[model samples]
Target: LIVCTHDLAVTLTQRPHHLIEYLARMKKRVTFLHLRHLYEQPRDKGSPYIRKKVKIGGVEVRAIFAPFPSPLLNIFRGLCVLLHVLLFDKHRYRVGINQGDPWIGFVFYILRAIGVIERYVYEDLDYNPGGHKNWLFKRITEIAEYYSIKVSDLVICVSLNLLRLRNRWRINRVIYSPNGVHLSLFSRAIKKKAHPPTILYIGSITEYFGLDIAISVLPSLLKKIPEIRLIIAGSGYYLDDLKRIINKYPEIKGHIIFLGRIPHEKIPDLMAESDIGLAIFPPSELMHYACPIKIFEYMAAGLSIITTRGTEAARILKKYSVGLIINYSVENLKEAILKLFMDGCLYKRFSMNSLKFSVKHDWNKIFHDEFKEIESLYLEYVLIHKRTVS
Candidate 1:
């Protein structure tokens, strides 16, 4: 069973895609339990718990949706989840794979203790506590995460930094599984044109994502390279705030374009149209451990990048010479953009290196390599359990 806090159909995003692909490749019979509001089909107005069957890449999948909407209602959601498992899922699932939802971990822990779940794996992709503003909520989240890490049989972290943090929990197994890109999706050869240079920023427009920093550097960038354009894509809580910020800067009005929330399939064409990619995450504990998927996508699309220092992805960018890493400041960002814009040969070299580095970090290769070792252990456990039962 694969458990996630986000809706599997609508907001699965990149990390979940990797997990789904892994399950499909391993040909594992799996049930996906989503414990969140139904964002994709908000008008359903049906039962709180909905069940359906779906197929992905010829793999059969059973999906169950249980809406919890808010963390304050976790107790109710936990009851709903426990009831569903006891009524329909008991003795049917061998392992439970949770995708880093601390709140939902409570139910999984209980299921494991009661023999309903034989094994549990917790996949921690991000440090989410830094994003929560309410002190009570943050404390609750921290406690839940601590218990989740302490109780899981295996812990999979997305970065070395995260793995190191989890080591303090004395977990039985902790594996580093970084974010990866779908190389084939962005491998199309794009012809370079002599039109105005464009810088692209694709991801959520959240305050911590540093979209404002990108906007702050636009005026200076336009002054250095008048033909330069900034294309801001993706939508989030800060969309209207970003628009207001852009409106404040009259000089950059015509030079900036906003393409709100581009579909995942159309991102490659958007990448092909741009010369540079911006991936600036503000300095925060949450971002320090982040391996942004956008960085890998930028590399896969063969675009030079400008990212803030101290992130796990920035280390890879710096190591491969695929992009520039600078401080999270407007001045540093402006300088980096100007330098890349002024040096055509350097940009081309970085672009080539980006593509070269991305090939080794493709999602298919990463999952195959990591899961080969993991599945062996899982199979042994399954065989042992079968023998004991028989």
Candidate 2:
């Protein structure tokens, strides 16, 4: 399989990592082509291309971290993919993962057309255009995504809403495969620590995640549990804004700890120390069709969740009773926070429920079932064609 993604799997563990890792464990011939942007690349760079055996959570992430002599724009990334297939890897792949950037998605689809790969699997992780604010980039991605979906042999959507939306767009080959977590990597449900009943908010520090609203209510939460802590991991554009919001309440200043851009390996330790795993994506079109991987990761860590309505995380909690859902308000946020930390029995129940839920949503199990279903469907379709010919 040839996997193409914009994110460096070795650094930030994401959707592509799980599938690539699964393929590697199965001993398949896998060559991953990924991106390393200007901001992320080293200052004294020797070569533009970096192909090495990198590891995530101690498991090897074999890849060609490709970026040409310029910015992380789609055009350059597309050129890198061409270089990788033509001059670098030079081997035909059975499965071509049209994963990450839309520019690469079109390239992979073309590769499939030319027999560079036998099948094209379009990974509809997110509506890239919807997430982008730039008009030109959005239009480019929208066109690329439309063509990719039309030409793909199979399409995997990360959420049910996305699946339905894609199907409505006339994609019959699409299926739902929500974001999953590596069970072995994330230590599940360590007993609640005695000091500082901690609430953890990890992943991209973006505005839509609803952390600001959660933090705004912290002053009220402090009235009951004065020593309660909120540890925020990961860096994003919203870090400065979040800090400004935190500064509004100087009383809760000591309670907040910011550990920006954590390594993948250190995440489990953070989870182990945390009392609650937090995800609160506010209502939006993009978020509505979103499946937050953090929800599964939190469950894998056996930490109870507190999320907002109209997200996949909320639906998961609604089904499993693993946590509470709050509207985008200070009062509800305060109430939900108190329940998880203050109510021992309820917290235990939610923790146990999360543990059980995590097992079912493990990356290994999810991929196994998904691949099995794909194989079965292939076989059934082939048999029908044979019968028709006979």
How does candidate 2 score on lDDT?
0.74
Q: Which 10-residue window in model 2 sums to the lowest lDDT? A: 41-50
- Per-model TM-score versus the true fold: 0.89, 0.85
Candidate 1, which ten residues in sequence have the lowest lDDT sum? 42-51
Clashes of 2: 1
- Predicted candidate 1 versus true structure: per-residue lDDT over 240-264, tens digit per residue: 8888888889999898888876656
> lDDT of each structure?
0.77, 0.74
Candidate 2 residue lDDT tens string, 76-150: 677666776777656786666767456666677668678787667777888776776677766877887787687
Q: Considering every candidate listed, which one attains the maximal lDDT?
A: 1
Q: What stretches of model 1 exceed 4 Å from their correct place?
A: 36-52, 57-68, 189-195, 380-390
Off by over 4 Å in 2: 9-11, 39-72, 134-140, 373-390
Candidate 1 TM-score to native: 0.89
